[model samples]
Target chain A: MPKPLLALGCEGSANKLGLGVVSHDPTTNKTTILSNVRHTFNSPPGTGFLPKDTAKHHRTFFTRIAHEALSTAGISPSDLSCICYTRGPGMGAPLSSVAIAARTLSLLWDKPLVGVNHCVGHIEMGRVITGADNPVVLYVSGGNTQVIAYAEQRYRIFGETLDIAVGNCIDRFARTLGIPNDPFPGYNVEQLAKKGGSVLLDLPYAVKGMDCSFSGILAAADLLAAQMREQDRILSAEGGKLKEGEVRITPEDLCFTLQETVYAMLVEITERAMAHVGSKQVLVVGGVGCNERLQEMMGSMAKDRGGSVYSTDERFCIDNGIMIALAGLLAYETGFRTPLEDSTCTQRFRTDEVHIKWRDD
Target chain B: MTASTGSQDFPCVLTLDVPFPTARLASIALQSLQVDKELSALVRRTFSISSSIEGARGDSDKILKVEYKATTNRMLRVAFNSFMESLNLVVEVMEELDADVLSTPIAA
Candidate 1:
């Protein structure tokens, strides 16, 4: 029997910094996750995390997180076969910060470095966790939104966002409502949306063939929120809650409406992709994939097509190092190692650029 | 400790060794501070993290070493001041909100 290969992964392409350990046994083609630790840099309400600030956050926590992941996995640096890290398709500063740490670890341990694409990491991890052989993937996150499928050594992007990503739209709306960012603005928005009672405000629903746009919807929602704020101030000064039929719009209503509209658009595109590829299974991954509403909508769509929808919980859905480790380990086993000089991170890395050597058919 | 007097080729040089509790903290500082784009054509900066050999003996202390070179003393001072502001914020964030201080349960 061939020996098991262990990999250490580092990921900080956005506000969250993560470290994880994964092992793969070639004899059985089984993968095991030993440890996955993450620390997020949540900005205050009404603000977004800047590249520089997020980079600083990754730098401050990378070492400690790496240490914790190693200890949790019960392995020392020498026990790993290679170090893996997210190489790009994210904010430049945060990506470089994590890359520098990975380079340092590679030098210290004399281990080869494996640079993995951020999107492919999410896809591979989803497949491993959900045990889905081949599914049309719906990837939604703060930085990206896309529907992908595998074909001839590439995960082809069938549909994607034309403007700001879905999670970004939710986060910006949460900011407009002054929601707390501790757990994540999107999760908070989801909680608030539960309080709303099907009061769908008229927001733009944009789906252009296989792609969607959120910027227009975001603008309209922001205007509605502003109008609500102005009315609230006037009503409060008059010493009364919203009177009957005064176009009452609460933050909860806005959140509910936004979630409904956006998830519908996502489902529309994902369904289109599945039908085009003639696939029976659909997989959802990325940070925003944790939303139950999206999963539910996709589930209904797949059910109508006599298919099934697969998704993992927040642990695997959201950005984490384990995904990077899994993807990089696959690449490493196929005889791939990034030379130190060529190990630089980039702000834009396309998913289809990667040659999917680990899979056939 | 000491500023390197400039030669004809490179005029002024300033070096700083900022200490942190651990090598990780120091490396974080180095990585964050190293991303700043050089504002002036006349100035250049380099940053690195160095752990004390005493760390191997159990102390575990590290330092972020930064060096700046400029065509003139005024330019060097200006760039150095801006760098210090960024460095201060980075260090403050590390001290107050790092994973060690904000050890909340992972919401898996």
Candidate 2:
């Protein structure tokens, strides 16, 4: 029996820094995850993570996390085939910090380096975890929101957000509510949304053809939140009694309305992509992919089209090291190597910019 | 320590010399550290390999040298501090993955 190819992956493109090791069997076409460890840097409530602080956090914890990942995987440096790291489409400082670490590791271990695209990592990992083949991908997160599908060895972006991403809109709204950013802001908003059936408060639906806009909706949501606060102030001052012609609004209503509206826009774009590509499987991957409501909505839409939705839990859905390892390993198998001089990170890498050499369809 | 700068107007200058086991390691460090340009316009930085220092004896080159220059002490300090953090991380990875760590029972 031949020994499986092992690769070590490093990811610090955002608030989270993760190190993982995975092994792929050439004969069986199976990927076995040996160890996946992550450390997230969360800012205080009502505040989003700044690039400087987040980069500091990643540098502080990178060596320790890498140690744990290697020890947990119980592999020696000489056993690994290559070192993999995220190369772009993220915060610049954090991405550079991780890239530096990866370069050091590649040189130290005497292994080749493979720079993996961040979005391609999410898409490939989603496909592997959910066993969804040739699915229309809905990639949503803090920095990205795109409807992607593979065509002619490229994950083409059929539609995307014209303004702020859906997750960004939700996260900003969470800040307005002063909700905790740990775990994540989107989660707290989702929990709050569960309690709100009050009336699907009016919000601007910004879907335009296959693309959507979110800033207007976010502005509208912010105004509604201010009104809710004003309503609370008035009720508190008026002996806790409602006025004759005033309408009641709550934070829960705002959250529910935001999720419904933004998710509807996402589903519409995803369905359009599915129809355009003639694919039935819809795979949702990224930080926002962990939202059950979004998954449920996507599932319903897929079922209506005689298909289904595939998603993973927070473990694999959120950015982590295994995805990079998985994607890089695939690229490595196809004789791909990121030369040392060119192992740099950028902030504006597109998904379609990468050649999907590992996939033929 | 202060390193010579080509421009006299940039008075604040600092240099760091990090020794590695081999010249290849020193070259690797230089390559990794030189990729990201300084974030501030007021700061300028450069990296190179320095060999055969006075009292250094090794199988390969003596040091990987990094120099920073800025118009103000505050700018120099901010940029140097960030560079030191990344440098420390690279050194730590080298310490953990190479240099005798791989042969050690526990680290392996």
Cα distance off (Å), candidate 1, residue B50:
15
- Per-residue CA lDDT of candidate 1, range A223-316, in tens? 9999899888877785766667777888889999999999999999999898899998999999999998888899999999999999999998
Residues A1-361 of candidate 2 have per-residue lDDT tens digits of: 9778999999989999999999998778798999999999999999999998999899889888988898899887888999999999899999999999999888777799999999999999999899998999999998899999999999999999998888899999999999999889999999999999788999999889999999999999999899888888877885686678767988888899999999999999999999998999999999999999999999999999999999999989899999999999999999999998889899999999999998876
Residues B18-71, candidate 1, lDDT per residue (tens digit)?
888778777666654564467589998888766653345545548777888999
Model 2, chain B: what is the TM-score? 0.80
Best by TM-score: 2
Listed in order, each prediction's TM-score against the native is 0.83, 0.94
Go through the candidates in order and give the C-alpha RMSD of each one to the true structure: 6.5, 2.2
Judging by lDDT against the true structure, name the best candidate.
2
The CA lDDT of each predicted structure is: 0.87, 0.90
Ten-residue region with minimum lDDT total, candidate 2 chain A: A238-247
Steric overlap count per candidate: 1, 0
